[model samples]
Target: MIGRWIFIRGQAMGRRGWLALAALFIVALIVLMPLRMILGLTMPETITARSVEGSVWGGRIGDLNAGPLPLGTVDAGLEPLPLLIGRPQFAIARDGFSATIAPSRIIHANGSVQIPDGLGGLPVTSVGLGDFSAAMADGQCTEAQGTLSLTLAALGPLLPDAITVSGQARCEKGALVVPMRGPQGMERLTLKIGGDGRWQADLTLAGLPQETVEALKSSGFDTRPGGIGIGTSGTF
Candidate 1:
């Protein structure tokens, strides 16, 4: 009789153990499902910008929560996951207006993977902006205080060695104007940077336009060879 009682008790305990395991498995599934939906998801387009002086200013929707919990609430029932991770793309015309001093068109632009702040509260990845313009205009320019600031690393390998100018350009009263210091003591030169990443400009001592050739000479760019020496500079 004692043996029978012991066997019955053991069976009951085994059943309860299986039930508990199933419940734990269901709970884990419920928790992880929402988490999978939040991370690394593509987001609706967004736009952000910074000034040439390096000030960040833009707005974007943060991580999205899938479960039915109030936004920004970190209670036991809430899951905070990021919906998208990166700076929003913006149209140049929508953000501001610019009159290209020269005829130009942007061909292509892309960026690297953007990671968001994880559960440990680390900062999200820095935003990246990349663009290409042809026959970049030279004219009057005006831009918001903080509309064109980009980091060297974010611009990619080829861009770090190229000169990048981001600001507003406009034609006022039939004259080109830019928000730049008056051309006084600075060496000014018109550079022609091609979309294929080729750099070329007038580089002749005697066979060049008199004004352009003289200007190059004045800037100490006059060298023995009558060809332009193309090289890269470490300023973007």
Candidate 2:
């Protein structure tokens, strides 16, 4: 009788051990699932990519684009700790720059991206962001902090040489605003981005020679008493 009791107890314990191991296996499988499987469900509509390959813990996104700007190929991964608390976060890195993205905000390190289509109607060559961050609520900007730089490409000899301007980024009336000025402070550019991905850019050149002003006017700029202004708007 004693022997039978001991045997029965041993069998039950072994079954319990196996059940625990099976449970752990299932959890591991779910945690390391491929990103391609869940990308459509987790990715934001404002961001798109040509291809996603690898597991959620670590993956590569090909030909990624933020609005209309290209981000090239980037390494990305999901933060598991955030998901446990119901707040999903994504970490992205490319060209030695990194950023963290949450549902309503994004934090960036120093980085620059080439503007293939320029900005609005201006022939912008590139954009550089330094410690830039922005938060949004209800389709509008709630907070914006950082510095921004833009390189305006020269339009041959008809226009001045390529010039870069630096300025602060801030929140203005719920829109994210960036005001950049060249070294001489004669060249200015303002950019605004809405939460819905719509954007507009305005460039003004002041104190230029009359000859140069006429050249700019011929290049589609509007002649104004203050200076020559060029404006364009589009959806990201």
Candidate 3:
């Protein structure tokens, strides 16, 4: 009778060991299965997603931690998996220009562009831009306030001898408008280039040079009566 009892106790202990092993196997499978699926994923169409609210856990594994994401978002329309593991590329249209950018929370983009021949045409081919910044606001595109330097090799053959115009411009009416200052000592100057190849400038010269005053007298730039002498040299 004592031997039988010992044998029964050993069998029970072995059964308990087998049950524990089976439980561990199940737990391992549960943990690894989802990770495998996530790693082997691909998306062919756009995915709409919302933030996960609470924590989740698995038995004998661990609690999963997920941070807050944007509330409601529509990803790129191509599907399988909406999230990309690596850098993404996309295009944005704003202010009459379309820009291609790297897809990220904060993106850094660099590319070469050509200014179009007309007011609204494709960009130039050889001209380039460096360190351009853009941001997404309310699901729309907005260019960040910063300096953009542009280089053009040949501007349509009409510009004066490959002229270089480098200055800061403000974004207005879907264009970059730069205000050029007049010549020295001139408060204001107006220049007009007509379609018939005629060029003219209206200038206000306050403290005029002696040579310029003499020339004005000869060329009829002097409009004042009684031989008035303007006391300054400037352009308007």
Query: Mind sharing the TM-score for model 1?
Result: 0.19
Displacement of residue 21 (Cα, Å) in model 3 is 22
Worst window of 10 by summed lDDT in candidate 1 = 47-56
Return the candidate ranking by lDDT, descending. 2, 3, 1
TM-score of model number 3: 0.25
Cα lDDT tens digits, model 1, 175-207, are 222222112312122222332223322212224
Worst 10 residues of 3 by lDDT: 58-67
Clashes of each: 11, 0, 24
What is candidate 3's lDDT per residue for 166-213, written digit by digit as tens? 223333333223322323323222222222222233323345456655
Report lDDT (Cα) of residue 166, candidate 1.
Answer: 32
What tens digits encode model 2's per-residue C-alpha lDDT throughout 82-190? 7888876778899846777766677764688888888877788887889988888898899888888999888658565898988988999889999999999988888
Error of 3 at 24 (Å): 22
Which prediction has more favorable lDDT, 2 or 3?
A: 2
lDDT for model 3 comes to 0.32
Q: What is the lDDT of residue 223 in candidate 3?
A: 46
Query: Which 10 consecutive positions of candidate 2 have the poorest summed lDDT?
Result: 35-44
